[model samples]
Target chain A: MADLILLFFLLVCAVTAVAQRELLNSAIILSIYSLIMAVVWVRLGAVDVAITEASVGAGISTVLFIAVLTRVKRREEITRFRVQVLPLIVVLAVGAALIYGTLDMPDFGSAAAVSNTHVVPRYLEKGVEETGTDNYVAAILASYRGYDTLGETTVIFTAGLCVVLLIRSEKKRRL
Target chain B: MMDFILAKYNFWIYVIIMMIGFYAVIAKSNLIKKIIGLNIFQTSVFLLFISIGKVEGGTVPIYQGVEAVYINPLPHVLILTAIVVGVSITAVAFALVVNIYREYGTIEENAILEMSKTDD
Candidate 1:
């Protein structure tokens, strides 16, 4: 039943992407998509990832796109069609390959899996002593992968700066 | 039946939501609509995380009776942080949107492009 739901949601995403005529409505659909995705992540047991996805994926990215949108005016007709036959074929082939790879993955949250048996046990047992932090995800993210986190922070900062530089104006438009 | 419904079918539904959101951000010409789509995308991800922490017959991760079997509290903590981050990002995005609206007379992508070309 869950699988069916997931399949249906995938259809929704595909339809939303391809069928929507109004950009604003598309954005709203995207927000719904993000919320739905958060639910999926929780089910998958990747709570940390889900948190990031919810915040950065749905929240920040949506806002950024909206801000960028304000700088432009809606055109009655699309001037360019970014879809090209070659790129479309390439994307489809890549997507197929990815789906094929999924066949090899362990069943979600199987105790036999390496993630549950090896790394996770160690974290659960000794993470407190090692990091002196109650939040293991925080410990892993901030300490174990501190450098990567720093890099990610820098990336966000840079993105924010770029957007500001690109869109800031000396005067205001009333519209 | 319930397990199959919750475990198997739910994942795909979330994936489709993501695609819809992605489509809105990419295909739509309107800026505000794109933002809305992006929000939908993000919210789906949050739902995914919350679902991950759920254990069958488990209660909320709070202090309770000795008989209670606790679900992992870590995900809950992480989400708390994520909530704050989401809000901050939204605030910043709104600031940018206001600026963008002021600079450009409209919110459509093609119109902005035309205006740019004419100016050059």
Candidate 2:
């Protein structure tokens, strides 16, 4: 039941991505899409992932996109020039192969999944004891993957600097 | 029959909400309206998360020396941080929007494109 709803939502987001006309509009939709993906992550028992998605994906990225949009507002009218059937066929073939590789996988919610058998159980048990934090997700994100988070933060800072460089001019516009 | 009905109907309803948010984003040219759609989409995801975190008969996590079950606190804490992030992003986006309006004199994307083309 829930799976069907999630699948349907995914389809909707895809449609929204393609159908939007304005660049700014599309960017906004993209933010929304990111937000929805966060929820999906949480529903799938990936609360930590959801937090990152909501913050970085939906929040920070959206701001970056809008900043870029401010500089270049209008999208170049997309014209489908050539029939690129060969590329499409190749892409589809690769996608199908990937899907086929997962044929022997356990059911989605099965306890035997790698996520459960692997690091998750250990984290669930030892996370609080080791980190001494009530929120294990935060501990994992800030401690276990501290280097990755630092890298991500640096990337965000770089993006912000780039935006400032691009928009800044000899005669600064009054904000 | 109950499970069948739940599966058949509830799934589509969530889909429709998501699509509406997505469609609004894709269809509208107005920057603000698109943000609104984004909010809708973001909120829907929040709903999904909250729903998933919900355990039947679960009480609030706060304990007053009572032995009642509680819905997981993990999702709530995560959401609190997420909401702050969402607001910050919105603030930055709006700031840019203001800057765009200042420089371009118009927020409409098509018009700006046309203006840039002629200037070029």
lDDT of 1 by residue, B57-111 (tens): 5443333443553344454445545554554455555566556566676666677
Please write out the lDDT profile of model 1 over residues A1-175, one tens digit for every residue.
5745754674575466445665555555555655556656555555565566677666766665555444444332455666545544554564456445434544333335343354444555665678877556676667665665566566557657755654454343332
lDDT of 2 by residue, B1-120 (tens): 764444234333444454455654555545654555665566555544444444445443333233444444454444545555455455555556656666677666566677889988
Local distance difference test, candidate 1: 0.54
Where does model 2 exceed 4 Å of error? A81-83, A157-175, B1-120
Error of 1 at B32 (Å): 10
DockQ, all candidates in order: 0.18, 0.08
Lowest summed lDDT over 10 consecutive residues: which window, candidate 2 chain B? B6-15
Q: Which tens-of-lDDT digit does each residue in A15-52 have in candidate 2? A: 55545556776667677777777767656555655676
lDDT minimum window of 10 residues, candidate 1 chain B? B3-12
True contacts kept of 1: 0.12
Largest lDDT belongs to which candidate?
Answer: 2
